[model samples]
Target chain A: DVKVTQSSRYLVKRTGEKVFLECVQDMDHENMFWYRQDPGLGLRLIYFSYDVKMKEKGDIPEGYSVSREKKERFSLILESASTNQTSMYLCASSFHSLNQPQHFGDGTRLSIL
Target chain B: AQSVTQPDIHITVSEGASLELRCNYSYGATPYLFWYVQSPGQGLQLLLKYFSGDTLVQGIKGFEAEFKRSQSSFNLRKPSVHWSDAAEYFCAVDQAGTALIFGKGTTLSVSS
Candidate 1:
């Protein structure tokens, strides 16, 4: 079975602090994505990486950035954490095809104070 | 741009009852539709997808969805509801590439 693992299941951060959320997939998929999920708003894509060192901004990528240094790992970076950024973060991986389904990680619940 | 809509924000049903969750999408041409389920504090799981050929598609966990081109709706259905089936459901549409645009989501509650 394919497994996507996030570095932390839950995290707490103070305002203005930098945060890093790590995601690793064992499937060797070529595409990785980062999304923040909020109540009523659902999951909005923050960023996606199709290959190592390649990234693209999604709909709600204003306050977030991502890094893909290796084929199996993708990281989401919060330059400065804020209260509004507090939400559940999900990481997903999929094949390079357009119709392939993405497999997701367990998710990280981030709380900023 | 592609968009998705899930009109119902929440729905309640009893166990062993049939269930249906409505999902509609907006796109210019043939669209790729998908349905996903997310449990509390967990990532979303793909329930079913509709690409081409057959309009009706069966998915994991006894879930199925039918694609309607005229209405642009792909609604999920299940014959019997289980207590463990309670979760938030999302409808999504993929336009030009791999990016998926999702709806707000509908929370399903299963009553005893």
Candidate 2:
């Protein structure tokens, strides 16, 4: 079975602090995605990377950025964290094929004070 | 624009009852549809996906979904509701094979 691992299941940070959320997938999938899951808004894509060192902005990418230094690792960075940035973060990976489904990590619950 | 919509925000059902969750999408061509379930405090799990062929797709944990092209809808159904089935369900559509456009999600609550 494919496994997607998030470094932290729960994280707490103060406003203006820079935060980094890490995710790693056992499968060598070519596509990686970062999303924030809010109560009513559902899951809003933050960023996605199709290849190492290549990233694309999703629907909501204002205060966030991503880095894919290695094939198995993808990182989400919060330049300046704020209270509004606190949310559940999810990481997913999938094969590059058009019909492939994405595998997701357990998710990281971030709290910004 | 391509989009996915899950009409119900929340639904409650008694154990052993039948279940159905509605999903609708607006796209030009035949769309790639998917159903995902997220347990409390967990990430989203792929329940099922419809790429082509069979309109009715069976998913994990005794769940299934059917794609209706004429209605532009893909609704999830289950023969019996289980307590474990209580979770948030999301309907998504693939946008040109790059990213998925997800619906707002419907929270299912099961009562014993």
Whole-model lDDT, model 2: 0.95
User: What digit string (tens of lDDT, one per residue) describes model 2 on residues A7-34?
Assistant: 9999999999999999999999999999
Per-residue lDDT of model 1, residues A1-113, tens digit only? 89999999999999999999999999989999999898899889999998999999998898888989999999999999999999999999989886788888989999999
Best by lDDT: 2
Candidate 2 scores an iRMS of 0.7
Model 1 interface CAPRI class:
medium
In candidate 2, residue A95 scores what lDDT? Answer: 89
Lowest summed lDDT over 10 consecutive residues: which window, candidate 2 chain B? Answer: B92-101
**lDDT score for residue A32 of model 1:** 93
Best-fitting candidate, scored by TM-score: 2
Evaluated against the true structure, the overall lDDT of model 1 is 0.92
What does candidate 2's lDDT look like per residue over B3-35, in tens digits?
999999999999999999999999887799999
Task: Name model 2 segments beyond 4 Å from true.
Answer: none
